[model samples]
Target: MIHSVGNACSSGEKRVRMPAVAGAFYPADADTLRETVVSFLSEASSAEADKEVQAVIVPHAGYVYSGSTASEAIKAIPSDAVYKRIFLLGPSHRAAFDGASVNNAFDSYATPLGQVKVDREVCEALKHADPVFTYVPEAHAREHCLEVQLPFLQVHLQHVPPIVPVIIGTQDLAKLRRIAQALQPYFTSDNLFVISSDFSHYPSYEDANRVDKATGEAIESGSLRKFLDALEKNARKGVPRLATSACGQSPIAVLLLLMEGRKDLQVRHLAYCNSGDAIYGDKDRVVGYHAFSIVKKAEADAFALTGEERAQLLQIARKSIDYELARKTDLPYDSTKMSPALQQHCGVFVTLHKGGKLRGCIGNLIGFLPLYRLVANMAKLAAFEDPRFYPVKESEMKDIDIEISVLSPLRKIQSIDEFQLGRHGIYIIKGEHRGTFLPQVAEETGWTKEEFLGHCARDKAGLAWNGWKDAELYVYEAIVFGEEK
Candidate 1:
């Protein structure tokens, strides 16, 4: 299903314009670049794409420094997104400029892969907002700020929506605020907002990590004032070039302001890397790249676990296991053991216990199994195949505990603000081993959300201490039940 829609030549075969930078900046060969892009996008999961994403912040450095990270963000984009226009904003790294300059080309932006159409309607609307918004091809022509992201978009979205590429050079907060505010009404799941800028450019890998982490935390918290304060603090100390390190600070500020109206802001860190992490490996001076998606959080499905329902689920798991193990036959439970409507959804987990100790837990994150069948199969696996314990001795059957979590399908969460700590269970898996605990697990363990995830990545997945960032994470709710106290 992955493909590059356009060819190396210009729009149609009627005319051709050569790649402006070619090998100097991006890959010269269309096929090589296509393959690289495919690999990157493939790494992102579309499971959450059914939920509309509000906006995304990605780095616009050369593909090598930021490509992989950027790919993660794009891949995370809900495949079902029906954006009509893409408003791309990036900080000007080229010659000094003032105001917002839109790329004034009738022709689509030509890439080795193909041309991405310009959204004339959006472009025209923006120009009408402020006189400073002028048509300037010179500003966007060789600008890697906006150009680099084009191919990534082309590779993923079937509909190549028109683009409004803006290069930010002036640091006038009022102007930037006005521009973002004006454009805010235009943003919807059907419309996309792209902000491009790298963080902590040319800092030592260690220092870049520290400063960038601060910036990222600030963004996640949705505190524009704090982010700006950090920049101001450094500037006040006569820290020359420190503000320059975060080149896209203005664009980020605009995004922060626009997102203010939205209460739900889950900024998922898709990928992050610097030159030091690249295969080419330049640790001495590194440019930090981060890709994140912001979206409005949909209200989670409301399911109050009635005492009757809890009792039914526990009995079902126990009987299902006993029937299979002892009677060597299928257990006949109520046809509505779990809601059929819920089964049609994805992301369910089953947990089994014996003598009040953990036994086996298994789940299909995307919700392939019906709620009832998922519980049945998982109960068996937890008891016999968990690998953590000897086969649940027949004698231990009386002491086993069973819990089933009928999870609400994961919606692509736009904002972390939507996440309720005690309401969601988290799972982090990468490579072979995986770590997961139900939502109640965190409450029981007295761990904060971050601490719980970190432990799951480290202790459960057997990954490095900070492995959560690179891990595949799925968050869900559990209809949990166990032996009555």
Candidate 2:
């Protein structure tokens, strides 16, 4: 049986929770802490900050080791957004107790940046909602997991909201689910959830890389069952000195439970690294860190081309390919006959196949030109400019298969479940390298979802076989049309 703990401090006196490791884990001085956090946020791409982020998974190791990786997720939150509360959850590293330990005894948590107020009302509500919630002062006295995240939140958010600090001490999934259920009403857009965790502790650099990649993929997959299966599998592999795949598995599991069945919410992998990569650490054995964000998709931002528009684009691609191979100077199309939809700008890809084998493929990811022009240009490029294949001769034009894929605007997804095999194509980007596979690739290769992602990560993006697990992954639906159709 679970029990509730914590003093109901309704008097509203600001009971302060002082920093436990201010100088050791991070800077002790206020200015230095602010400067260090600002530098880390600056390293992240500003474009990610524009997202409507709902939650983030960040590493909780000391600043010298995992700070940069944690910044990738923290910086992704738009500074201007307003939140009623922030739910900060982490696993207890110092104390062992049952269920969740809420720190309602403190009115505010103090760090170098400043003191952040605790949401006493929410804490009281949580206590009433579930028996698993209790005030365990010892559980948080020396815990570094939740403390490490406060400075980042203080610096990145334009307006700091009161936090519901939770220390997960129990590993029971049933109790965690009840806790999540209790919090579900408050898990709205007005609140943010931050799960603090570090991955693959005390393993060789290579082994950590391998194990962390699998763990990351499982988390991003958004299937709690899959994540647990992978976690158990990694534990059984017996990697030398590997303590755990993730330190905050329970907190993450709670988030996963909250996210299940919500198609609008998507998870994006922002950054990943191990302690071995840090200047102060060695490559022999290291701890791993990863950052990820859960964002909400705006339906209004996505655009879909009509059936007639798709047909016209297909015709344009086929005609362009035919003309290019014939050495003709002009494509055979009446510009006046094109509909308004064809005049719209959209990215397109033209693929050519001979005897059911890939002959050539080419396209642009950004929709800079009109649909017809983009398709025509890509068709010519696919036939002759593809470096992977020889230029198509006029004789082969009759036997060639032309296919056009009209794409929707690419939107970053939070989970692998967002990708529908044979329906939505995937795009992966990491640094300057990127790889894309059309929805049909899944159908042709008959690969499972994991295999499909593995191929794109390894073969196309030049990352490792499990690279997509940590790389930025986007999903887009395509309207595919073929000559036979």
Candidate 3:
């Protein structure tokens, strides 16, 4: 039978869980720690999200190794953001136990930077609410994964809310599901969930890249079965020295369980690298790191771009491809001259047509970078990187026409009745099989609702024509503009 262990809190004395790997994993000095974290955040890519960030998946290795990647993930949370509480979860490398452990006994968690208050009440309630939660001091005694994340939170967030630290010691899916369900009430826009993990431990550089990419894609799919299958597949490949695909598999599974039915939550991959990418590291054996942001996007019609904004995007797209094809420097523009809508982040797709024929198309469903920058990147991809066609040549530039599609956050739909043919685009999902047709696709093809879904399932997602009938359906609207206009 399963059981719980350790008391929620002690009645006798004040308790503060102090740092364990302060001098090792990160700087122990207060000022140095502050400087290091600040540098990481500043040096991270400038692709800050203009969307609401609800959670993040970050690496837990030493600051020198994974700090840049971790900072990239944390940077997704807006600088002016405020939260009610933060739920911190990570796999415990130091202890082996039957269930997960919640930290209720400690009043605060101490790092070199400062002390962050522990949500003792919430922790106690979690312990009482589910047998899957307990207080195992050993689990966190020497754990550096979650502890290292505290400093990033302390330095980045203007108001670092109280945290409820959870350590997962079990690989059991049932137990992880229980933990996710217990924490479901706390997972909301008002709170932030930081999932601490690293990817592809002790694998060769090339193999680590392959394994980590597969694992990241599985996580982005938000399918528990797919994630488990990816892990099993990686193990079966027999990559030399590959100990694990993702060290925080249990915690990630818990997060995926929470995301099982939420369509508004878009998982965006931010950055990736291995220790081999670091300055003082070996390429033979490397540990990989990946950064992801789980955004709770606003409604599909939250805001729309104006005509001027749309025109500006078209100009940017044309220039992006021109610069790339001409082998010139990147397109440059003054940020002050741009509209607020252009600066806001939104998912965008770029389509290219040559002499009124389909040339190339590519896009990200949920983009975290600024609208202007995302459009430029996608435009280049459509012109040069779409795998379906050969790279575009300078001679083809004159005949190329560019079209941009800005998409809103995806929301789950009950039935085809909710999907308007010309106004709403449909995204179909069935297990690992998924595909999408932009809203304009309906207008372009004049396809019926069933035909639209059928084509998308078969041609795009590799599912049977009838596969979308029993699959999970989602609908999103897009703002489309083209150079022809």
Candidate number of the best lDDT: 3
Q: Any runs in candidate 1 off by more than 4 Å, and if so which?
A: 1-19, 44-50, 234-243, 300-485
**Where does the lowest 10-residue lDDT sum fall in candidate 3?**
1-10
Q: After superposition, how far is residue 101 of candidate 1 from its true place, in Å?
A: 0.6
| Every candidate's lDDT | 0.68, 0.83, 0.84
- Per-residue alpha-carbon lDDT of candidate 2 for residues 16-58, written as tens digits (9 for 90 to 100): 7777878888888888999999999898766647457789999
Q: Higher lDDT: candidate 1 or 3? A: 3
Candidate 1 weakest lDDT stretch, 10 residues? 1-10
What order do candidates take by TM-score, descending? 3, 2, 1
Clashing pairs in 3: none
The positional error of residue 340 in candidate 3, measured at the CA in angstroms, is 38
Candidate 3, residue 220: Cα displacement in angstroms equals 1.4
| Of candidates 3 and 1, the better by TM-score | 3
Off by over 4 Å in 2: 1-13, 300-485
- The TM-score obtained by model 1 is 0.57
Superposed Cα RMSD, model 1: 21.3
For model 2, give the 10-residue run with minimal summed lDDT: 1-10
Q: Of models 1 and 2, which has the larger TM-score?
A: 2
